[model samples]
Target: MRDSSSSSSKPVLTIGLCFLVALLEGLDLQATGIAAPHMAKAFALTPAMLGWVFSAGLLGLLPGAFIGGWLADRLGRKNILIVAVLLFGGFSLGTALADSYATLLVARLMTGLGLGAALPILIALASEAAPEQLRSTAVSITYCGVPLGGAIASIIGMAPLGEDWRVVFYVGGIAPIVIALVLVVWLKESQAFRAQTGEKIAGQGMLAQLFGPGHASRTLLLWVACFFTLTVLYMLLNWLPSLLIGQGFSRPQAGMVQILFNLGGAAGSFLTGRMMDKGHARRAVFIAYIGMLAALAGLGLSTSFAFMLVAGFVAGYCAIGGQLVLYALAPTLYSTQVRATGVGASVAIGRLGSMAGPLAAGQILAAGTGVGGLLLAASPGLVVAAVAARALLARRNRQPQ
Candidate 1:
């Protein structure tokens, strides 16, 4: 095991690798959503069927997170992450040739297992290697990969083949294989993790430790936050393009709007990381959520393409921006012994929200509620999340500074 405590060569390389892994995590999330419309027509999918495609991957994620967390503690982060990348990358390539809706569904589920494992393990490794003064910033910077990946997926979805979303999937899937190969040659195990593993962590079970008394409250809150955030974020990400197309934008135009949304998210993520580094974690999250609420409301009322694009950017900014807080916050909430467990639990819970987002949006669209109506319906979740962030911040402030 290698400890990255000093300002040295391996720590820098490890952080860079963590950044790449983080990007892949977000890219996988955006793939299904950005390509949803094309996928729907290809399979002649009903709204419910499309919803299932989104949820299937999320379902796999729950178990993946749990198992990956436990494995990180037992076998170390490097090995588990390499396996996850290969698993997801291989499954994503398999999706390119999926002949039936059922086959596609299964591939997504398998991909979710791999994708789910990547985040926590990466976060755990980055935190271990980062210097204390820069830890939060590094964690948040690594998290920027999600929005950047999502943005890339949107850009790729706009390719000449138009609605043949399979191309995007193939590219995303293959990337992890490349990453895994590189990691095998370049990376090493974390020294802090290695030192602790032989002692208390040796016989610990993740499930038991995650639910243990001292950690119970923080664990519950982490899950609640993740669930709400994912539900809102994924619902919008998965359905927004189709919703725009329904409003009369062509598929290409709709994808373009999705690109703008990702662009805003990417910008927001970069700024959030910088601000969190400068000690504005709570303010940054609160303001971002406020912007999200406004963007959603504006989206419900606007019909102009320009307005929609602007609204999409703002909405994405707030929606995706909060991830910075989650990435930096989750690891710190628990001790090193359960760091992976905490991150895995938060992500697993969040997947529940992610699964619900597409389902609820699908039902609304199928029922003729329209995109604006659907967005308005979803706004309350953001409001509640804002309130929760405030409460959490106040509590943290009250704790001795």
Candidate 2:
């Protein structure tokens, strides 16, 4: 009975810890956008420079995901996750203290490294902690913290902090360190990882692990799906408010939309995961991508505040929710041996898309592309993502499950 009780609590403890870290990550991820105007004013940054500022953290994520995953597979998930939390938390503080553009970029880049590293580990831990039948639900529950955290950041940004953008970073940074301590006391290493034999745990080289035997096709497909999906998601996350303001919406109205978007994302993340777990993987994919495309069109064409709010919520629902679906799918594709490595690589590739999205949006808008044109251009990518994700699910279904 004691063993049963402890076993039952493992998933709860694991998912709870992962969720806290994810929450802090979400806060930091959106912090820049919330504080962008103040950051721009304080440092006298141009639009181009602000784009780089957004990309800097994403740039860190690319390598961080790869290296963090590689190491997690060999070392252990909980240890690496704790280190990642500390790294990001410390750098978040650095972000608050940065006095120059160069310093700000460096701080954000370091913060990205920690954030990037923490994500794959979180996914792996949550997926491993839950029963196989409930894997998607577990991961989605952990992932919901991200959008919810972003909503919190939006609220902080709206507060009368007197435009002291540093406060946002300070909050984002300090909370993770506290969580890290809690994790140190409570988090457990993945039982699956512990159960693996030494030889299997030390599996083939990185290239072989990813491209080994039947993995190449799925790996490529997952990358394609993640890349395009994140491109749309991050573009909206970093640029949505500015886009709304460009279209004549007030700042407060834009902020409200942002909050609703994240709230919708939290709901979508949970629902989509539950849907996939209920043997509706294909249906979930269809709904997520189709909803994304339609939401984009709505955001582009809607003229009223009410309509735009609905559009933002739908966009968040589909885009951020779609991302959770991809994440949940990633772990099932690889064995416990290389799970983190494979997931990390997929995440790293997706980070490239994330980095590109914000920069591309900036350039496109600078080139006189209106909000509608910019949103419309994303349609093709979502279509590609939809096709790749569906194909991957079809392939998974063909396996001897």
- The models' CA-based lDDT, in order, is 0.79, 0.89
What TM-score does prediction 2 earn? 0.97
Clashing pairs in 2: none
Across residues 1-401, which tens digit of lDDT does each residue of candidate 1 receive? 24544437777888889889877777887788877877888889999888889888888888888788768877889999999999988998877778899999999999989988887898888888888777776776677777788888888877765556788888888898999999999887887788787665534455455666555555676676667777788888888877787888877787777888887887777787678778887889877888887888777777888888898888888888876667677777666777787788787878888888888888888898887789888878877766666565555555421
lDDT of 2 by residue, 273-360 (tens): 9999999988888889999999999999999899989988998899988998899999998888889999999999999999998888
User: For all the candidates, what are their Cα RMSDs to the real structure?
Assistant: 2.8, 1.4
Predicted structure 1: lDDT: 0.79
Best by TM-score: 2
Ten-residue region with minimum lDDT total, candidate 2: 197-206
User: What ranges in model 1 sit over 4 Å off?
Assistant: 1-7, 202-214, 397-401
lDDT of 2: 0.89
